[model samples]
Target: MSEPLKSEIAREAEALGFDVVRFTSADAADGAGAALHAFLAEGRHGDMGWLAATADRREAPLALWPEARSVILLGLNYGPDGDPLSILGERSRGAISVYAQRADYHDVFKAKLKTLARLVQTLAEAEVKVFVDTAPVMEKPLAAKAGVGWQGKHTNLVSRDFGSWLFIGSIFTTAELPADAPEEDHCGGCSRCLDICPTRAFTAPYRIDARRCISYLTIEHKGHIAPEFREAMGNRIFGCDDCLAVCPWNKFAHAARKTTLSVREETNNPPLAELLSLDDAAFRARFRGTPVKRTGRDRFMRNVLIAAGNSGDVTLMPQIEGLLDDASPLVRAMAVWALSRLAPQRLRALRPFLAPAEADPAVRGEWLEAAA
Candidate 1:
């Protein structure tokens, strides 16, 4: 395709609500394999073992589909107006990742990617495929290569236009397109993102240990949360966005123009009491079209129980009390821990549930320890 055609496609992408669009030859992403190897060698990927396997393929986009000649990186800004991190101190409420505080980005981003790809195909001749986070595409590195943003020290892509709140998507195609100049890194001498991590998930500049990342634990880890990090999780019921929220660059971010991505009143700061009471069906209904539904009720509640333990509100004891008989042993176990942190009167009220729980040896031990 001619350079003019590429420019027109970019203009159309912007019109479709994408903040930035740039092109790169699929063969240009050669450094991805080595960086991924080093990242995996340190076990920094945590339980996300998929990254280790896709290292080679992710390194070069052409490897995924040899027929693809160009990759179009798309970025959408989802920046919030206020400090998303400030809500962390409100222990009685839940802190959701800023991106997740509105509509789910996957659905929003994928629809936009599809629209852009269709428009590109109509203007130029080529086979096109759309990918958001659903594919093995290394969006941050590719976005940097495409001039959409630079990957900051926190390892998330940050752009001058969208700050650190942009959602990345990509279109791999058979058309030859003019590529954009790559953006320069601007995170000079700034360690705010690294120092702000609750679990110190960053091992060094630009690398995050997914295992230690609260986002990974609360949303992706299916089993019981590792005991050591439970207390540090605070009341974040869904994904944690502390690192992204603390970035100084967000000051220039524009509020999401689309109301769909704007913060919903109920989601911006949900009451902890209300969130904990959601049964499976209610959880699904309430979180419909939202990212929290991805974690399912069990995993989400596991996070909630950890938060309840940290709440220091004896008034929540009754809600925590009812969870003792929850079918999932993980939920029951967390209830016992939350009970242990309750004030004396509330703890006394929990004794009846603890006494019957003795048949489950694990529950018995927790009950004995909390009662003592």
Candidate 2:
């Protein structure tokens, strides 16, 4: 009875454009709770307090929704057409993570998941709910357990077929569906992913500290960026893809279909000078419908200013200089650092005029630190 239901769900998932689909019981992902506790205990999750707040729900599907009997995990291929790391050499241009270059994956995958969930409900007469990244879903471990892919050393889901580029989502249903065997980890002794990190976010093979991760710093971090990470950040304005890009498994991956995620040409490696000019409205208008916009103008500009600081292009000096008076202290702090990097003499020349008037202590600290 459930075999037919699982088959129908699989067919519907494919029809809805999900590249891969698998099923698993909604039981606790074995030992995932312990790992979650350990990660939080060690403060590896950084500023993402939601992870700690929803530990029970994140530990298992049933914990999230007790009615959930089986989970339908899906992976959508979002592999980029070229090398994601090549942008690092273009210091004048900002590097956005390949997954973020287009439409928000959360929106794209959630729409397809809802479409697929309806089929599960109709076929088995069961209650169902769909989830993308927004929830506290342990998608990586759950996907790995469902044979969607294995969590590689970098602590991300890795697929032999789709490589590291799969955008994973899941559907939980009350119906009991057939479950797939868990995928085996094939990253034996392959240290490429861990070795390639710019900030060495990985403390060990599978353990990561988000505090040091550029992706976390540029996107999730809400305060003044730590001074130590600034120079290593390069032009990664939104998120870092270094670990994902270096995965050897990505060679077999295929680019995501345009219908699933259309690449926004304007955001693809936009000039640091141009990005520094965005005010609140322009930033929202430019990154609308994309994950980048969710970071908001202040944080996004902070990342851009870091990129400008690393750009070494004197032409960006004026744009960087203007941000010294930005409304957001986060923006102004980085602007001071950027000025110090791009044009120290100019920063020194303007210091007597600007330093005394600075109100925010963090911004004042940046001025003192840079002037030192």
Candidate 3:
């Protein structure tokens, strides 16, 4: 593709609501493989075994698609209009990550990516493949290589123009477009992202242990949350944004211009009591178009129960009480934990009746541990 065509593509992407666009060679992502291997070797990825399963393919764009000669990295800003941490103080309400407060970004970005890909194909007569977060592509490193942003200390791509709030997408094509100069790391002396982690998920600057990440635990892990991190999880029901919210770079960020990525009022700070009452159908209806739906009713309720336990609001006892008999053992177990924290006396009183009826060993243990 000609340099003029690349400029036109950038103009077209900007018109499509993408905040940043740049190009890099497929080999620009070659250095990311070693770090990924090291992360998996130490099991830092935790229960996200797919990261291990797809490590080889994720290491290089060429491995993903040999036909790809150039990688076009696109970024869409989803900056929050207000302080994301303010919701954390509202302990009775759950704090969803700002990015998840809207429609699923994959759906939104994929459509835009497809449109841009079609434009590129017609202009360059090149074969194109587009990817959002779903694909096993190292978008952050590729974006950094493409001059979109540097990978911040939090390991998220942080742009000088968009701060820490950019959602990345990529288009790999057989066209050999001119690659942009790589962006330099600007996170020289800041450690706010590292220190602000609720679960201390970051082991060091730019390195995170996913097992301890609240986002990973709440959204990706399928089973019961570990007791050690429950108190630290706070009221974050969907995903944690402590590290991202604390970044000073966000000051330069503008509120998301895309209506599809804007925060929904219903999801902003939903009351814990209301979330606890959601059944499968109601949960689906409430989070139908959002990323939270991927967690399913059981896992989401389990997270809500954890928040309820941390709330210390004895008034939520009735809601917690009802979940004790929930069909999901994960919910029942967390309900016991929440009940124990909020109403230990009631838990003590109901133990004999509840204990004998509980068949799940984990649920029985929660009752025993709470009573003890």
Which digits, one per residue and each the tens of the lDDT, describe model 3 over residues 1-372? 479989989999999988889999988464688989999999999888899898889999988998899999999889888888998988999999988999899999999999999999998899999999879998999999999989898898888887889899999999989999999999889999999898889888889899999999999999989999999999999999888888888778888877788788768879998898899999999999999999999999999999999998988999899989999999999999999998889999988888789999999889889988
lDDT of 3: 0.91
Best by lDDT: 3
Residues 62-174, model 1: lDDT tens digits: 77889998899987888888878788898888888887778889999998889889988888878998988868878788888888888899889888877888888999999
Candidate 1 local Cα displacement, residue 144, angstroms: 0.4
Q: How many pairs in model 1 have backbone atoms within 3 A of each other, for residues 3 or more apart or on separate chains, i.e. clashes?
A: 0
Measure candidate 3: CA RMSD: 0.9
Residue pairs with colliding backbones in model 1 are none
lDDT tens readout by residue for model 2, 84-161? 899999999999988888889898888888888887888889999989988988999999999988999999999999
Name model 1 segments beyond 4 Å from true.
28-30, 344-372
In candidate 1, position 231 carries an lDDT of: 84
Q: Which RMSD does model 1 reach against the true structure?
A: 2.2
Q: For model 2, which pairs clash?
A: none
